[model samples]
Structure formats: C-alpha cells, structure tokens
Target: MSEQRVASPRTFPTAGEAAFREKVRGLRRWGRWGEDDQRGAVNLVTPEKVREAAGLVRLGLPVSLSRAFPVAPAANNPNPAEHYLRRRVRGEHGEGSVTDYAGVNCHGKATTHLDALCHVWNHDGMWNGRDAAEVVTGDGVTFGGIEQFADGITTRGVLLDVPAFRGASFVEWERQVTGEELDAVARAAGVEVRPGDALVIHSGREAWDRAHPRPWGAPDPDGVYRLPGLHASCLDYFHDSDCGVVVWDMMDAVPNEYGVPHCTHAAIFALGLPLLDNALIEPLAQVCRRESRTDFMLTVAPLPIAGGTGSPVNPIAIL
Candidate 1:
C-alpha cells in the first residue's frame, strides 16, 4: 500500500513583523521600498540569497480557491442566449427605445454558482453556529452572505486534471470518475494533495457539452450528467487538509440515476467546506498547458447579493 503523506503544519509572519520589515525597508529606500535598501543591505547578500530570504518571509498559509460559472439565459438553448433581456418601444420623439435586463437561475443544478452558507442547513437547525431561523428570513436565508465573499477568496488551489492525466481528451458520458482515478491524476500531475488547498478537478466535461448538448437544467439520459470529478478518497484528502473550499467543473459528483444524495457533497459539507459547483476550468487548463505549470494567482469574487442562496462569480487567474 502507498504511504499516506500528510502535510506539515505551516507558520506565517504576524502583522507586526510584516510592518517592521516594511519600516526597515522604507528607511533604506531612496523613495521606494527595496530601492536603496537593496543597494545597502542587499549588497551583503546575493540577489538569489535575498530572494530566498524574501521567499521565507512571503510564505503564507495558502492560495484561495474559487471559480466563475458561466451563465446563459436559457437552460438548454442550442445557442444559449446570454443573460441580456431587451425591450423595445416606439415613440414620436424617439426612433426606438430599448431596455436591457438580465437575471439568472444560478440556483438550478446546471448553472455555475457558489453554494451560499444558507443553501444548506443541518437537520439540527444551525449554520456555522448561528441559528438557521436567525440567519434565514421568512422566505429562507443564511449567513456568510454572498457579499461576505466579495472581497475575494484567499486559499490554496490544487488541480487534478483527470482527463489530461488519463490520456483522454474528455470523459465519456455518464462515466463516474472514481477515487482511484483522482489519485492517479494527482500522481500524474506530480502534486501531493495538501489540506487548505482548494481541489480543482478538470474532467473536460464542459467541453463535452459542445458535442453532446443536453437540457441545461435536466440530467442526461443516464439520469446524471457524466463528468470527471474527485472520488471518495479525494473527499478524505480534503477532510484531512481541513480545506476551506472545494470547486469543481461538473454539476455534482454522483449521477442522478443513483437517486441518493451525493456522497461527495454530503461528506464535504459535513466538514463545512463550501462548494463551488459548475465551475469553468477550461481556461485554467489552457494556462497550465501554456506555462507547463499548475500554480498561479487565482481570484474569485462572488456577487454580493444579500439573502441569496448563491451568486454568479467572475473569477480570474494571473499567471
């Protein structure tokens, strides 16, 4: 059996220590930090040595993980309409008038959306410590409001490109990606799963949609949309890491035919890790391929819609 490798505990500098470093650098700066400071203090150390020291200081907890789910007006439109509503009017003074409106059904299973804290409530009637009633309104509500995540999510991201690792461009329809498959993909990627890192799995499911289009909100003939995703063991990996979040390119891990609540969802949610479902990961794949690298600066900012179960996100990556 393969040994289960665990991540070591990590430490980071306190705010005060960071401030002190900034102060010292400012004193030596000829207007900007690190300018004159580098000339004087850095002269004693080579650039590579300085870089090594800076790297140590810069090391923090981990990267944030999140993704933007692409949205369209209709669930299964062959030419899915963008979320733009337009109204036209005829007037004597004006040739024509048009009003644009846009609304999305992000809550639907197929839509790309973040599961708000309220989206799930334990049978015990509490969410992250607050009473479900207190956080939820008469209509239904919860905390860690969508607005709370607007500033942006900060955590580590680990990508397990299942399709690429499998030597297949895409996963076949209705095919369930197993935990073993996920581990194999991680191994192929040369990444050691770590806790606190957002696990992103790309099964090429999104691309499959182009060739095998299905109703947006409806499941495929197999009773579930087939997509590659983390297996049960991957969930254990997340649990061990104490990960703050999990995002995926597929709608969910289990097929609809199974008819039972998704095990992956139940397991992760039980641990309080928020799920970002229906994520767009093709771009991330492109970036990784172009650079021959998997790590990069990933930013995800969800819409600040108070009382909403979930919201659309515009996520970007800076390599």
Candidate 2:
C-alpha cells in the first residue's frame, strides 16, 4: 500500500495570529470593493473615505435624483430689465440696463429652493440641537444655515414615480397616498431602496405643467392644483432608514388643501432632514422613460447666502 503522505501538522494560528490574520483579511475584503460599495466599509483608510463611509452608514446612500424646471420669478418675463427697475446708462459704451433691484422679492421667484434646516420649527422650539429661536436672530437670521451646503451635494439618489405605475398623468394632492401605492410604484420603477438615499418622487405634475402652463397670471383655482405625495407613514419609513434628503416635484409632501398643513414637511423637517422643494421633474421623467432607469447621479448646488432662509439651486441629473 502506498504510504499516504502525512499532512504537515495542522498548525492552528494563535489567538493573536488569528486576530491579526482576520484584521488583514477584513482590510482586503472591505477595502478592495468599489468606491460606491466601499463607501461605508470598514478599513476605509483615508479621512475622505472615512467620511463618505460614515455618511453612507448614517444616511444609507443617495441616488442621483432631481428635476430641473424653468421658474421665472413673477412668472412673467425673467429678464432682469423687466423684473428690475432699469436706468439707461449713456457712456462711451453703448446704452445698457442698470437694474435697480432694491425692492424685488427674491423669495417669490425661488423656484428651485432648498428647505433649510431652520425652515421649520417645532412648537416646543428646538432645532437640531439649538433652540429654534436662538438660531434665528432678533432680525430673523438663522445659524447652521443652508449656506453651509452650497458646496455641490454629491450622493446616491433613488426615484419613486408613483403616477407612472398606474399609467396616470399625475398624482393628485391630498389623496392619502398609501404604503401599498408606494410598493406598487417601486415595483414599476424596478428600484430597490436602501437606507440613507435621497428619495425623489415624480408625480407627473411637470408633464401637466408642460401641457398646460399655469395661465400666466391666473390664480390656480381652489382644489385644481392638488397632487399626490408621500403618506404620513412614508415619512416614518424614511426617518427610520436614516435618509438625509427628500426631493419632490411639488412644493410639499402632501397636496395643498384648505384645511390641511403639510404633515410630510412637519414630520421630516422636525427630524433634521433637509428638503429640495419645487424641483423640476421633466428631465428625470424623460430619463426614466428613455432608458427605463430609475437611478442616476444627482448633483445640486444651492446659492450660498450667509444668513438667508433658502436658496435657489441648479440641480443636474447625470445618467
């Protein structure tokens, strides 16, 4: 009988050796993945990597999610000369329009706006950690302001187009959107949500706007402007998942109704989640329609103002 070569004495690593081996293996396993997946992995070596990973672990991850709309303040002509009082200057140079923009209301034309953390205040008056009243100075300036976020936002973004699933034109506001509706939309969009992602909802209102531009100066008839929104329960779901931001096609989470306040705003803002309101959804919808993709890269940069309440954002979606 051929003598079977005896296997070398099985050497068990010592406790220290085993732990060290595990450390090395863990490093290789965690650090070898792609930037997106390794965003929150252990053994993230650099400070930036650590921060990215921590944000992912904290907020889950974001999807490229935002829409661009053409918003003209005053909804008339956005031309500077038209909106602002202009003085014709006669110099060696040809005549030019010098705008006297002292009294124009910037807030009215803030179509692509970010809801600063200070935008909402609980009845008790606490904001983040500081008292709400404290953050807002006597003159109404806020601290830890949205200006801090002016550096273009970068993160994973997810889309949930509920109206698309039903083949409906748009979601009507104040309609008590249910969790079941959300699940159906996810199914239609083929999106699998993870924690910490910015949730963007497209209600098809933009398409409606394109088809029927809100009459230049006509007031939106009562109840004619309603659109679908996240149910109150949906806010609970996102809060539990550690989502950082929510971008919507409409101005609020729920439709504007005579008797109802925006509960979605109350629920989310109370938890420190910033909002991207009145976002344009046409581009996002087009991308979804063309490529059939529900995810992409979303980049939005808000104008940095020292103590401003909110800022207009130029949001871009990279497919």
Candidate 3:
C-alpha cells in the first residue's frame, strides 16, 4: 500500500530561548538522584518496577525490536557497521576458535541503538550540568557514557501506535505526532504511561519500509523526502509521564517550526533521559493489536563500551 504523508502546516511550540529554558528547568531531573548519578531517568526502574513488569509477560512471547544492520553503506548509512574476522585459532592452540571484530557508529538513522546521557549536550553541559570540556574529551565521554547502562535495562514497555490511533496504515512523513496525540493514543489503547516505562512511539516505520522497499541511504535524500516522526512537543508529554526511556522508530521530524533543531535531544539532555532511536517495532505493534494490549516487559542491554557516547542495542519486548 502507498504511504500517506502529512502536508499540512503546523508550528512547534516553545521555540524561544526563555520558553525552552523554562521547559528544560521544569522537566530536568538533575540532582534528583544525586550529583554522582549516572543512570539519569533510568534510575526510576526500581526492583519493584521490574517485578511489576515481569507480571506483564503472561504469554512469554518475546519479540525483537531491532532493525537488521546492513553490510554495505546504503543511501542513508554513510558509516555502516564494519565486521571482520580478527582471529582463528586452530592446531594445538585451541580446539577451534573464531573471533570477529565489529565497529559501528551507533548514532544514526539506520542502526537501532541507545543514546547515552552524554550523547547530547547544549551550552550548559551534559546531564547533571557536567562541563562538556571535562566530560567529553578527545578520548570520548568520561562521564554519562554507555557504561552507565552496563547492568542492562528492563522496564515496562508502552507502545504508542499513532497510525492505529489515526485509523491509518501509516502516517505521512509530513505529519508529526504531537503530545496530545500521544496522550489520546494511550487512552485509546487502554494503556497508561507510568514512571520508568520504556515509551516506544511507532510512527509509520512499517509503512515507510513497505513503500520505499529499499533502506534509506541515498545522498541528498533529505532534499528528496522526509520520514514521519514524533514532534518536539512529545518531550513535554514524556516529562509529565516521567518516562525513563524514549524509543522511536524514525526519530523526529525535520525543519520543524522550532528554529532550534534537535529539540528532542535538547529536552532529553535537560531531563537526563536516554533515547532509543531507529527501532523496528512493526511485529510488536501487530502483536499488540492482536492482543488488544499496548504494554509489555522490555529488556535492552547495550555493550559495556567504556567512555563511549552510545551503544547499539537489540531491545526485546516480552508479552
């Protein structure tokens, strides 16, 4: 089926510096957990929360929410992951050993990865106001890196299927999912966004994939087309709900009304929140539709890359 694209004009709210600052201050979680806190909003996932999430796995059905990484660079992936055989031990050295090394630029439109707290920064600093010069050095991020999530992440997953809420197969690229729409969808789906929930917003990635067929990686693609994604205002909803982690299939819309770009990242940084970008959630959406449920147990464990800004993750949803 052909995909629907939004073409209507709309303006993004809270674009001015004063308003943006207030927004940031209103939702910021800095010092909430303590100065030395590294988990950011993820600290909301307490043992009791994990117990509650476990109870949601009645069917014991686990679905992966990661996109397949491409071997060669595509039109959208300028820096595709590199995997090569590093060593092979044979003879008396060992019974048989084959080792492979992989290198990836986790933050992009192609790979499914987790953006650590240090991934985004503004004039102020990184999460908890850590000076960028001190935290992010030539070596990499010394603080708020992916190592903070080394223990792994597990929480209740809430699927906000905007397409379903809009009664469409896929929302058009020009269309942006607003915070009000997020709340409406949650109410419609009979689910509620609770504190520490891993909020996964599905903004027509399935529909776009079906229409485009090929993966995004073409040069000058931005001039060619835009992908459907959440509006910057969704951060406001996230703040109110106390979302621990925000996951999206396509990220955010481009050329928004807000003069400041990457407001999504800015809001996250202010709130000391982590983000999971470019997730594959079509199968999970289908399962949710069939079961008439939008909440499940989610697990995401990123590589323990010390001093790394982010890490590729294969998030799983267990129903």
Candidate 4:
C-alpha cells in the first residue's frame, strides 16, 4: 500500500481559499469592541457577570484547573521549562531564591496554557484586522499580547464533562468533539451553557497520556496522533452561545477529519476568541461530581508580558 499525503502546516485554505475566506468573514469579530479595541471577546465578561459568578461560589471550594507546569523534558515536551537558582542559603539571612523560565515551545500536547489574541494569525492578519507583520515582529507582538489580560479573568464557568457523560475514563484517542457531542454532554450533565460563561470541555487526554507513553513527534503513518480534541465546528457553538473563553483538555484535534489543521486557531483568530489549552479538567470534574454542580466562579490571570503571545496560567474554579 502507498502512503497517503497528509496536509502540511503551510497548506493554505484546505477548504478552498474562497470558501474559507468567506467563512472567516462571516464569523470575524473585527471592530466588535471598537476600531482600536484589544480585549476582543473577553470584553463580554462584564462586571455583572463577575458578580453573578461570585454568587455561584456557595461552597467556596477552589479547585486547581491547571496541569503541573512541566519542568523536565518528556516524550511530549521537547523544549521543557527551565529553572535556575538565583540565590541560595547564604549569610545570616539564609535567604534562598530561584528563577524559572520557559518558551512557548515548552508548551505542547499536555501543558496548561492560555492563548493570547496574538497567538494566531489568519489571512496574514490578527484580531481586528491588525497587520500581522506590524503587530507581531521579531521583537514580539506589539498589540493583543497577554498584557491585555492583566486584570485577570473572572466569570461563571460551565464544565461539559463529556467523559463522565460517556461513562469512560477518557474519550477515544483521535476522536473529534463537535457541537453535537458538546450538547449531549451538557444535557446529560443537566447544565445549560449561558452567554459569558467560561466553557470548559474535558476529554481526559492528559490522563490517557500519563498512562500510555509514546514517542510524541509527528503523527503515525496513518496521519493521526494518539490524542482527542475539539473539531472546528465547535467554534460555531462557542460563538452562537456567546461564550467568553473556551478551555479544553487539548486545543487541536490530533488529525482533523476536515483535513484543515489550523481550523481551530483560524476560527479563534477570526472571532477574536481566547483559548485555554491543555487544561487539567479532571480535578474540576471530580469537584463537580462531589458537589453535584457544574457551574462555578472561575478565575485566571496571565502574566503581564507586554509583548508575549501567550502565557502559562494557573486557573482556579471555586464552587
């Protein structure tokens, strides 16, 4: 048998440039905030929404929704987080200190991170039609960087526990989760996804990865990686439902059925939507199960990097 040709990352407009461009135009949120706005969809998280979210924290139980920051290299993390001791126990003070650093490349497959609006580009532009070349340079992104989120994200969170609904430890590897599956999970969980909610989809990918280690590089000869993730169609639901943020166990599908590798990022770019990728949703799942509730007060703060494209975040959900 001959090997099949897989789509390359640079392959423009897998669904044809004309149709993809029109789709992007239809969903694009450029000027949704204003001609010079930078916060994008997150602007939907109003003060009223935050106050409402605070009301949901009846139990005041906070559960961490982030994966352990990967500090060592692994099969999945080619460029791991770095750490150094700036000072150690010395002198009468016996003071100690350390510094930690990581590049975006350190985050892959399993790390929990937040994607800033400048993290992706579509049609050679960014959110609000900002020129990619001008906004993003070798120096770093001058606009739409993580600094836009300095005040932090505080809103109501709705967890669609797909694994729990399916009664499985994890979704099948390489499975695509679309609006249908999301609706089913939400219904089964007895929850409704409301506007301005921080929607989180849990697929149990991290648990599977921990139990089964494999060489993590390119896809297999079959053109699919052993992971589960969101399908591009999910973006429509996100936009129609007016969700402020989309958090997922994994951001992109291993190998999408549509053959459009960048569909998720492209939709995110067009819609000015921020993404929370590789979130550790299992803990949240457990907490929801224990409390018999899925809605909570979710809060996340990204590092104030003026020109950074994304940030390593530790989100918390309080019930």
**Which is the leading candidate under TM-score?**
3
Candidate 2 lDDT over 1-319, as tens digits, reads 0011211223211233233233222222221233222112111123443244344333233333332243344332242122356678787888777765432222222255676655654344323334666678865455546675666465556677766776777665446455567666776667766544566777666565555556221224442323345555555554454555677764443222212334455532345566777666756776667766676556667777676566667666555
Tens digit per residue, CA lDDT, model 3, 170-284: 7665677888899999998888799999998887776876777555323233244344566778888988899889888867665455444466777557888899988888899
Report the error of model 3 at residue 318, Å: 0.7
Per-model TM against the reference: 0.63, 0.63, 0.88, 0.87
lDDT of 1: 0.50
Worst 10 residues of 2 by lDDT: 1-10
Question: Could you list the CA RMSD of all candidates, in the order they appear?
Answer: 15.7, 19.7, 4.6, 4.3
Error of 3 at 277 (Å): 0.8
Clashes of each: 5, 19, 8, 0
Per-residue CA lDDT of model 4 for 18-82, tens digit only, reads: 56567667778788789788888889999999999999989878998887777777655656776
TM-score of 1: 0.63
**Candidate 2: residue 250 lDDT (0-100):** 49
Model 3, residue 26: what's the lDDT?
A: 71
- C-alpha lDDT values of all predictions: 0.50, 0.50, 0.79, 0.75
- Of 1 and 3, the candidate ahead on TM-score is 3
Candidate 2 — which residues are off by over 4 angstroms?
A: 1-110, 138-140, 210-228, 253-260
Candidate 1 regions exceeding 4 Å error are: 1-100, 121-135, 173-175, 213-217, 221-233, 256-259
